[model samples]
Target: MMSLNQVCPYCDITKINKDIVSVDHLLPKASFPVLSIFPDNLIVVCKACNEVIKGETIYLPIAHPCYEEVSRHFTFVIKENNNNKFTIEIATNSKNSKLINQKIYNFIKLFKIIDRYEKYMTAELQDYRTAVRTPNKCVFIELGQLTLLPPNLLLKRLFHSKFQPCFSY
Candidate 1:
């Protein structure tokens, strides 16, 4: 069995101390019985992202966010306007656009992650707004311009810090 501390191969979020949730097959195991035990087919995902993303579908061609280097396949774009509000856009049309879009849509609808995490996302947006408005000169100078990293990396870092013991084994 894979360790619970294993970073989610899909989201790259640490899963050490957090509730283990479940293992997700990169490919739907039931649909591909022959490859059910394939190492390449398995991924650890947080319960929220997994349950929300996995709907009725059995097969998805999109790269698993955890184990697979899916960052290469997608990009995030942030836009700010005169009103000073910011909007986040996840690029869906990259090399794996069709496949990725389908998987993303499925994930959004099935997992209801958007709805479930609306408050969290909103709070983060507010933080960004404050940062932009106040402009922390010292921190910005020391750290350099804060580039928004992908969600996977953010999740991974949060998971790692919060659940350090999970990585011990």
Candidate 2:
């Protein structure tokens, strides 16, 4: 069941190799043992995300996947560096609400999402540059391929402007 997911929703680790995914209790089983039995409380995440990033720490405002579609409130800003690499930053879509913005920030911090992405971006950017530079190669930038990287904006802009006409089917 865990392998069915292409990437970890929290940390965005691609499930390419072994089964490095594990079940994580969103509310923490140590805190709410009764909810441990509830399927809704369980979220399948990467091993690093479950054990290292989140650990036993609890988060308020509950970005529970079952109840709240909290991800829509966040946006990833991708900036191209002069060295042909990219830097990614997460920004909250909700500018007016402090509480909503704080929740978004806490979620990012708790999972160390940016740190993880930064590590992967160097390699992914290199691959991206190579794919784009190669001629007649249809570079399909699927949203699923990107996962938490960018839902829409980043690659779309890159292909249009930087890559100078790449094909996506």
Candidate 3:
């Protein structure tokens, strides 16, 4: 219960805001009414991952985030596209069981995580570029004025913020 609340375990990217957080039945209350209030059955997620895509959808016999370790099932890899934008993709290493693979697949598809992450990264990259190209301010200071989300974190991680056209963070 404590582990599921601060960050969205489902998407791994969204920082949980108290105002927008949602309680998701890891095992849906709709199907497993007996376990409806079970402590282990609930997970906290961002609103987009919960109400928007995963309402009432259930996948059983899979690696539950509460029961099984998530790193054993999927990995996040961020890549730069040919268009000079960034995108994040899940790399599911080869699993011994086909069912395990399906669980990972269903999790990714239902949450639309790949697209969501790509969108975030894309916007961040654009902002970083804009900040660097700003005339008077330092890229760091300029980006601070641009958006609240930390672009420098991913910017530093992927491209190391070594910009050719603009200043580095």
> Could you give the candidate ranking by TM-score, starting with the highest?
2, 3, 1
Give candidate 3's total backbone clashes.
0
- The runs of at least 3 residues in candidate 1 whose Cα sits more than 4 Å from the true structure, single-residue gaps closed, are 1-3, 13-18, 55-59, 65-67, 81-85, 92-119, 135-138, 141-169
TM-score of 3: 0.63
Worst 10 residues of 1 by lDDT: 137-146
lDDT of 3 by residue, 1-169 (tens): 3653465778666668778888888778888999889887777788878898789886655567666555466655656568877666666766536877777777777777678767766766576666566776464344323232233343343244443343344
lDDT of 1 by residue, 14-84 (tens): 34445756666656766777877888766567764556566335434444555445555444445554665
Models 1 onward score TM values of 0.57, 0.65, 0.63
Model 2 scores worst on lDDT over the 10 consecutive residues at: 155-164
Q: Is candidate 1 or candidate 2 better by TM-score?
A: 2
- Model 2 vs truth, CA RMSD: 6.1
User: Can you write out model 2's per-residue Cα lDDT over 85-139, one digit (the tens) per residue?
Assistant: 6677876774528887777677788887777667665566666767766676666
In order, what lDDT does every prediction score? 0.49, 0.65, 0.64
Give the count of colliding residue pairs in each prediction.
Answer: 5, 0, 0
